[model samples]
Target chain A: MSDTTPAVEAGRLDTEALEQVLAAPAARFRHDYLEVRGLRVEFDGFVAVDGVDLTVTQGDLRFLIGPNGAGKTTVVDALTGLVAAAGSAQFGGVDLLGRPSHRIARSGVGRTFQTASVFDELTVLQNLDIAAGARRGPLTLLRRRRSVPPEVEAALETVGLAHVRDLPAGVLAHGQKQWLEIGMLLVQDARLLLLDEPVAGMSQAEREETGLLLQRIGEQRTVVVVEHDMEFLRAFASSVTVLHQGKVLAEGTVAQVQADPRVVEVYLGTGAHGRGSRTAATSTEVE
Target chain B: MSAARPGSARTAVARPDWWRREGVRLWGGIALAVVLLVGVAPAVLSDFRLNLLAKFLCLAMVAVGIGLAWGRGGMLVLGQGVFFGLGGYLMAMHMKLSDAGPGGVPDFMLLYGDGVVPGWWEPLRSPVVTVLAILLLPAGLAAVLGLAVFRRRVRGAYFAILSQALAAAFAILLVGQQKVTGGTNGLNGFRSFFGYDLADPVNKRMLYYIAAGVLVVMVVVVRLLMRSRYGELLVAVRDQENRVRFLGYDPAVVKVVAYAVAAAFAAVGGALFAPVAGIISPADVGVVPSIALLVGVAIGGRATLLGPVLGSIAVSWAETSLSEQFPSFWTYFQGALFIGVVAFLPNGLASLGGALRRRRARGSAVPEVGPASDVRPAAGSAGGVPADPPAGAPDVTTDTVDTAGRHA
Candidate 1:
């Protein structure tokens, strides 16, 4: 390895290769809706998101991929203002680094947790209506005012949950709940959507559907998804940023990054990049 | 793949047709019952009995606030008694000042220490000032306290402890301020309200009606709140504060608003309670009494629309009647009742109706399979299902674990 290309040359090889990678149907490159600079997040003594610099443009479908404990979620948490960060995270023109989660949300950065955050006791429509910010006016002063907005129905329709709109979110299947969470994000109409492992436990068919859903959503807003499932990532991600030890290991098109030797050693290790894995390496090469 | 999954037996029930169902019919019947009772009770019951009911109504008013804050907002508001006491003390001070006439000191002030009323108590001498103070003081205190605690992100057991400490501190302060607060005895021995002689039977009945009217108004107001967007937000804040924050709303502000509204209602109840109960003692504003108020709401079904009111009234009635019959055992009996209710009926008595209906539906729909027998596995495996578990169930961790496990 030492007899090989220089550090900068090796880095540029992956970057150049990544640029030539083909875009997936679900994942399209966003031109820079969010710009994060020198981001640093520390937990007591441990650095979580260390000096990470990334940008997510409008309509960008970015993937934050790494192995477990790679601090990928920490970066997402910092972007959403859930965790305190010591660097600049600007969305549009707003600095979200020190702002509260609510302020960040108001500034058009919406997020979904690894687990569904829907109100279990509430009806599915109510969940969407609540997410859509319905019942938030002077009419809420009066008792018996409507809880659901007209947009709630539209959101449910988009998520293919209109038929079960009245059922409680708690009763929905695992995949349906994930869809409902996405519908909530959609209803919010956030400029930047942060999805944490959207297809973590879904069936193959469900994951495929979610990929299609993400593809549709990516047309309207920037979506940054943190996922470990390489198949789903390959099927959805246009631009993948491989994170390892709180630093960006590789950033470019999936194919270019997959061919990067550094990414293979750190991220696309034996488990993720087995020999003869067609979807893992070959698809990226074809792109 | 075509075979029905054995574990997928519990499907989410279709949304209830609230308008066309018996639920609406049952609600209608309850409304009718309330109307009939209100209409005929005044004429049929003795004045003494009516007065008691009025007092119960006032207590119910306080419970309404408790229901909204603690029950729905997930704020364990242990200092509602502070608001209640504030209202009662204000009203009592005013009535006392009036009875003293001109510049004369209230009788308690002369007997205890200084022959002059305190400057703080001076404003409350006027009926207008007293009523306003009664309404504003509790709400103001609650708002300040709520802002401080909620803004700091203090919730669950910490919030409960903070509120309870406030109540304890308030009661002790009042007790220690003998010169101004009338010490442990508290302000009492009122002769009249407005110009109406409180001693007169008709006036007493009128007070009862007023209290009843106020209780009804408070209930309606809370009902409206619970149904409104704010109500939904309040519940959402209770269920998932962080999620609510991520939805473009400040959870602290929302919680504080609900807490303050609840405090205001409790103040109104306390003000009326002073006149009807004929006393405003430190005992009424202390920690133990505050817990007692929560007991009623919890037993009644804290989250339900009418649970707090019904539960409060029922508890108060039982306390009065039981204490009168067996004063020695009443406290112990009440404790037992709370323990039993909390243990067996975790959702409160209000949920019994819903539970019974569910049972009946299950019984009719699945005659061959017993619902009771299936409950264990259904509960065990229903990780993704969104059933409203009983209030006391330790389901918070379960939900978190299931969610994490699904994704992991």
Candidate 2:
């Protein structure tokens, strides 16, 4: 956008970077994982996603930024195997398209819900214990006790939730619930963490802590955060993909995208809160 | 215990220590249950009534299972009677065969016009085979059913309807198979239990002890399950299934195992019920009876460890007394009791004492103040931690806020 690239001027995709990245993504990446190609999701006769391709290198925190109804969550839902999707979604070298949600999660691709979804009745320790896959079998129920994994302990300590480890999760506030969910994904040893609006309901200070938390998590796992918070994305997202109407509207640095005349006029209206996802699911009509 | 924070903090503070208080309470409850079961029942009840209580104890075994499945796992298993009936019939067939001696058909088969024993019944003529069938047959059925339903992700009311339909179908099938199962009248009038003559009052008392022991074991097993990590996972599945799945747990496997255990318990109950009740019929293993098992649990508190057992016995006792007093209308009275309990005591009778205690303690608990911050950001540290206080913050009021707060 800043360079006056002809493809942006012409109102069509400049597929050079997307194609190059998808084709030989392994050569350019540290972790070099998560290649999605021509992924399409449909419901009834409507196409929610129409021929979208993405390649995420491991350990890079890529922010998937888009307006409301841009099929950002649908993308995560597809990768998480909650929807009937066509085309390839691969984690490392393994296909993720047809696997169940639990299998995909167990296979190192962890996802949090649009709303904070933690087990409300379970204690913080119990919640993390399940994510760590500790003593889960029926016969294993006979075992007197299992020691807490060191990693789980570290996660609770890191999230600042070690004190409330014994209290039921339902007692936690909104921000704490979000942090707890992320902690759950961390304990799952998720290689790729897909977080949807990780800071949606948090206050300014909590958002900062969460942003710092996400940045720290990004250092370890490949995190693809689907958020409408452009300011938060601008603060931490090193590379960004701008989605509009179920396609990659733009892809580059936040400054580059903000500078693009087409992007300024066509998307990112009224800053971050304009393109919200509260009505994102039903209001969007498929092409 | 605060209306602001609904955990067991205020009570914990009042006690000597958290674990000791909880440990004492748990052990006290267990000791009291054992005393009442072992000491008081035999001394108080007549032989006829004690036998009835033993039958109810077997019913309570199934209720204990229902507490785990329907209560903890959020699986509404209305077809437990399928397993219960199968075990009862298997045990009955074995006992009848044992009574008939070597290489002989049961008197019912001969007198009821089927002069030869069926091939299926022949294998069950062996007591060992019968015991194994009682243990494994119901489990196998439940495993298959649980796998099919849960793997397909069928849950909630659909699951309830499916289980009830199976129970109905099983009862119909049993009713149609008159020669083998003894049809509507059911298999009864057993002469012996493991060669102990049924006529002997001492052996009858032994049967009561057996029922009592088995129920105690089932309660303890269920208590262990509820306290275990897997038990917590089952409750988690019941609450937020998709969340559990995303946490890399197969909610289906968790559900299936709980269902199978529930089935096994019900089957065990049925096996014991045959020896104690001296009968098993379509009337006792149909949709009505299956739902009847749930009534006590619902009244008692399905989620609590002792609630289901205590509630089952209490309901059975009430039914006995009320029926003697008003034979025709006792069922309606029982129905009213169930409705009232469900409406008023949703958490059941087990929580009643806790609720009363909390109400009384509400006024006295303004005594303490600890700062609302733990090094763990205390919600206040983060400056945006929203509504409840941070984890270690002491709650002063022992107000009545439900532990299971409603979620969307």
Candidate 3:
């Protein structure tokens, strides 16, 4: 895998470099930012997520990495209104604490389920079409579904599934299904996207394609990915948030977090030290 | 295994463009319907049979709405009988009052309603208000009910139970209000409709024609609605409700509107049914008929455009004929038929074409029957992973980082 780090800055990248970054997987895209303070999620008195704070900016491809119960997915779920949440979350100027999930989605937030929850029986094109026009209401019942907007067409191309648009989503390969779900987010004009394990079950080549697609999407939208693939993240993530026991343990660039004593202790003791190497190494060698 | 798919590809091109390749079936259906309803029924059948057919047509209207609500919207609306009964009773009351001429209580109302028209019966005295009530009452009830139930996120079988309970309650209330409602014997003996003499054979024929025409119009209207964007949204909600919610749709609103449309359709059917059958009773509006309506929809293929209507008419016709053939056991025959269809043709008769085409491929595959029986909610397991990693799988769960690409 390519080890080149992205030239991530606070503001917009120029168009020439932006286009280049959009083409390459490891390049950064630039400005929707998210700020969270004192976020807590409790289920039946068990604290699933507790007192978490994070700041993320545009094209800020941040990775949330932890063991199974680290509360990474719960944090995303709370922001998307899946699980009950308390405290404050501000994304693109909207307070996203207790609003309904649909409302949060309409407020420009998008999320994907870990199990890849798509309308499996529908054609890929129909899946995107429904999401593309998700805001339609009951009064529009008499009106025919209009033509696919250019955004959907662009998303089809971006996810590289334009040719298979007529195929049912049930038959899609695992990686393609993941991309199609992301394509759904893109079609909804979502500004903030929370992806749950995007690269899981993908082939090595498919992972590379997804990383490039994620980078390309980040140029236009802020993406927060919850993933366990550290070797994949090391090459692609400009920033990383390490979680342990329902709280953020460390937040920094990949090398910085890897060097932190607490992060090393947690990961090493958990026997995850082999997955996330400190320096550039063969991508598949550890696996 | 090597047979070509002839129509699926042409579904997009090289076909009459109106309904796409589906247009062929559409035009054929219209032709068949016209021949059967217009040309053949009046010419061949006696007036008694014709009236029975018209009554079946009215019931088909209810099936149309049920197909959309229960079949597509996934509401499991076992309370449609309540809406149907309400509309029928409203129309029957208006007719009974009108037939009493002026300043007189209806014959049955005099006998059982304590010789006084209830205050609520006064508004239905005008034909325009009666028509409007028939249209709005059920729709309004459904809207209120849908809003309350869906907002609470009650769905699947619980919604079914709630709706069935509503139907039972409605029937019970009608029975208990014997003074106002003619008791369980119900309302009947209408002598006229508006100013027209109901005793006149021509007027009865006209009413029959009206019911047939209304059924046709409703089918067209439902087809238009099904072709629209809302149809796609409805189906999406059915397949993956949470996914639709995350896509920025309130699943409750989508469900409520569909439920309301169903209620409206059932209302109209009931209004016509009272006139054609010359009666409206608690017997017609109870739990039994509600299940009967769904049985037709299930037999016909709930999702197909013409399935519900045709299935309803066929089932009603079979009831008449089979009962004549086996007077004591026809109900059992109907039950057996339903069981056979559910067991063998689960997607309904509409899918027979696809099933025939797939016979070769089917032999090697698991024989799955019935959409109702086949498709189920995704197992509670998320992609086969438990909500939490079980203690047994600690190697994968405790060390997700070390597992690398093996995250569940």
Candidates' C-alpha lDDT = 0.76, 0.78, 0.78
lDDT of 2 at B131: 84
Which digits, one per residue and each the tens of the lDDT, describe model 1 over residues A1-287?
11222211100012122122212333333333789899999999999878999987777789988877778899988887788888898887888988888888988888888988888777778787778773266454344444456566666666667777766677777677888888788677677889998887777777887887786666657889988777777778989998888988899998888888998887686534554664444322111
Please name the candidate that would achieve the greatest DockQ relative to the true structure: 3
DockQ of 3: 0.49
lDDT by residue for model 2 (B209-256), tens: 998988888888888888887788899999999888877778898898
**Better candidate by DockQ, 2 or 3:** 3
Candidate 3 wrong stretches, greater than 4 Å: A1-31, A137-141, A268-272, A275-287, B1-20, B360-408
Q: What are the per-residue Cα lDDT tens digits for candidate 1 across B129-242?
A: 778887887898888878888878998899888888989999999999988888999988988888678899988888887887787777777776877767877888899888
| CA lDDT for candidate 1 | 0.76
Off by over 4 Å in 2: A1-32, A134-141, A144-146, A272-287, B1-23, B365-408
For residue A210, what is the lDDT in candidate 3? 76
What is the two-chain DockQ of model 2? 0.45
What is the docking quality class of candidate 3? acceptable
